[model samples]
Target: MYEFRELAKDVYAFLQPPLVWYSNAGVIVGDKDVIVVDSLANAAMTKNLLSEIRRVTDKPIRFLINTHSHADHVYTNHLFPEATVITTHSGREQTKANLELQGEHSASYAKFFPEFDFSGGRYTVQDMCFRGTFSLYQGAREVRVIELGAGHSESDVVVYLPSEKIAFCGDVFLKGMPPLPLEGHVSQTIAHYKLLESFEAEVYVPGHGEAGTLAHVRVQREQLERQFERARECFQKGMSYDEALRAFAGDVIPLEFQRVVILASYCEFTGRHPETKDPASQSHMSLIQSVADELRVLLGTKEVDKKVAMSR
Candidate 1:
């Protein structure tokens, strides 16, 4: 399920149910055309989004700005055939690489979720790619798409409406969900939050969860700070990745997500990727996989779907 919110005059948000892979999107209606913030996870969801968009205005979608290269956000890019898709150069490259791994991802996800299907889905990369800030005017409204280095992903960007003080911050800010430092570092994610707060937007639409104010941004920031501090302290004590995970094992955050953040923080401080030749990092990655498998055994489809339904 999803909720459509009219954030401001001509500015709208499509908030998806809070769960893994589900993402929020936005629509900006211009005088003659329209612009979309990000695409949803799959084909069905994107179709629903398009239907809601048509209900508001039948103007041609001039541009579709992607916030990052995550599968959930970019999988349905092909849906908007006429619109020019925009994303960071790194994002486009990542999307191309990720496309190759879709089969593996689908197979793995199928083991845990048989109903979540990706068959018959088409993927798309950005038509226009840039390194830094890209600004365009939608009639008179200034829509600024700013790439905030790396945060939730290597291609993280925030779509800000300067005149209206509304920002569509991608995975950089998740209101109810824990921010996954999936392909990025904790330090950078924390830094990006500070920069987002500096925007002082009256309304901030996160990549997931409902649109909120700066206060929501701050709360999420504080959680990141706490997790980072704990992880750092464990690292300073020369604790192994497993030891560090055990240290924060009692955290209220879901173990599946908390472990990833812990591993990410560990990698950030050590300056190494799990896929690197480093033995320690490889072991950390193995631990993450073990925990994931354990989680799958514990929470079956019914429990996971129940959680998703409750999130709505």
Candidate 2:
């Protein structure tokens, strides 16, 4: 079941009912008004969040702040038609494009998940869009929404509540899961993380996973930096994309995730191309050769299980 937990006196987070993936929604309630961070993936789930908010206060929900333009983050935005929806200018464009794309293809995607229905529904675009910093005041409290340009997505925004020392960071950081670098550049992502570290928020709310501290965010930042640096080193050494893919893949880690990351990294490093030979194929091959050689050396010193587990 979906449940909402109060993270602070005026902050509340809701865990979406577990499905294939988990997502979170948050609310910042002031004495006179409230603001919702992101809408859930579907109408029913978003309605549940609205119900929860109604339970705590009768104050109207004045703002719907979208962190990015991902379908899961803004799909149910139409539910809050009365609220002024706000997001980065790029996010607004992406959201409009995504909605049109989803409306045309969501039925096909829904076939993969027979449990949920995706019919003639549509998402609402942001009413207000900004390029840099935007602020909104609810009674005496001020909420600052800042766009940290092109990190996780082209329009990633972090909402900060200075009075409470709390931040609702969108998909820029996740707690436990290795961040999915699908629509992002590694360098920009790293810079975004560094900017986040500079903030003095006591509580950090992620778009996914549990709420955490600045230390946790720092660790994730470091992990991404390491991954990108390693990938770049391999690329600089004349390693093909496929060679790099195989160098990292093994029986220990799932092949699908590895392939996706390798391909995504290749696109980030070399730029996407349809006519050129598949660079990922070459990188994958090199990766396999490197891993095999490393394994052989480790086998002489440790058990196979220990060696395999240590790779990650």
Candidate 3:
């Protein structure tokens, strides 16, 4: 059984079973209705969430709010067939795209989890969608669902319960590990953080971290700023993406972090901005230059071991 921790009077969080790197779900039980902030990665995980919610309240789930379109976040929407699945306009669109790629995506994951069933056999599609801010009344308490603009994805929403002083932030801030900017624009992501900080929530529940204060969110913002600045500096210096990654290497930086930085830098140099239409061609001169520049930085920093350098 997965452990459910109550972060506030009506708010609860549970770690997804099976130890999937960074996945968690939350429940908000109001006086009259219940709202699930995010569904789990698969049918089994969603079942666990539903069972746990039943333990706390018999009230029907009035809404299933998706924070983004990530498979881990929305794949289980079908579990709550009766509840309305709501998300930002962009989120809805993205989920539809995700569904189209579900087969291919699942196959990729199956490669990693060879023994596990990757097909989300029980997952359902979201039926309802909204834009900007929308409020729902659960008896007397009002639950505000607002899209804080493109940050982690083209469409990401943050749930706020002013009455409870609690906020459900999906993937905007991950505790312990550095923030993941997989599908985001650095400038917009930083801006989104500032907007999130302006909210008056006392407790913030991240998509993949311990429930804590808004300060935790701010820390993520700081880290993102540092990464963006580093990337930008490398770009200005005409360092290639790989070179930038090599230059930034340190004992404190992990291999995964280096890979992400390199990818992000490459994307930036190639002018592959998120939230935009796909490019006609993936190849670009800017990307080549960026990679070359990055390589130079790496060689100068001497971070790559002699063996690794020779291997390259």
Q: Cα-based RMSD of the predictions, in order?
A: 3.9, 8.6, 9.1
TM-score attained by model 3 = 0.81
Candidate 2 lDDT tens digits, 4-119: 88877878887642122235788989877789998877666666788999999988888899999876688778888778899999999988887677645475446434434443
For model 3, give the 10-residue run with minimal summed lDDT.
274-283
**Top lDDT hit:** 1
Q: Against the true structure, whose TM-score is highest?
A: 1
Which regions of candidate 2 fall more than 4 Å away from where they truly are? 17-21, 111-121, 251-261, 273-312
Q: lDDT of candidate 1 vs native? A: 0.79
Q: How far is 114's C-alpha from truth in model 2 (Å)?
A: 4.4
**Cα TM-score of candidate 1:** 0.87
The lDDT per prediction is 0.79, 0.70, 0.67
Q: What's model 2's lDDT at 11?
A: 83
> Which model, 2 or 3, shows the larger lDDT?
2
Candidate 1, 1-312: lDDT as tens digits: 577789999899988755556689989999999999888667778877899899999999989998998777887888998899999999999888877887776665565445455543545778999988979897778999899877678869999999999999998998767766766488888888998899999999988777889999988888888988888899899888777767776667756567667778878987875343423235433433444444444557577566455433
Q: Can you write out model 3's per-residue Cα lDDT over 1-312, one digit (the tens) per residue? A: 355888777788875322232367878887878888888766666666788899889999988998988766887788787789988888888788767777776665565444344345433568788887989887777788888777566777888888888888887766654555655366666777787788857888777646768888888788778777877888789876656656776736453444444455456556664222222112322222233234435445344233222221
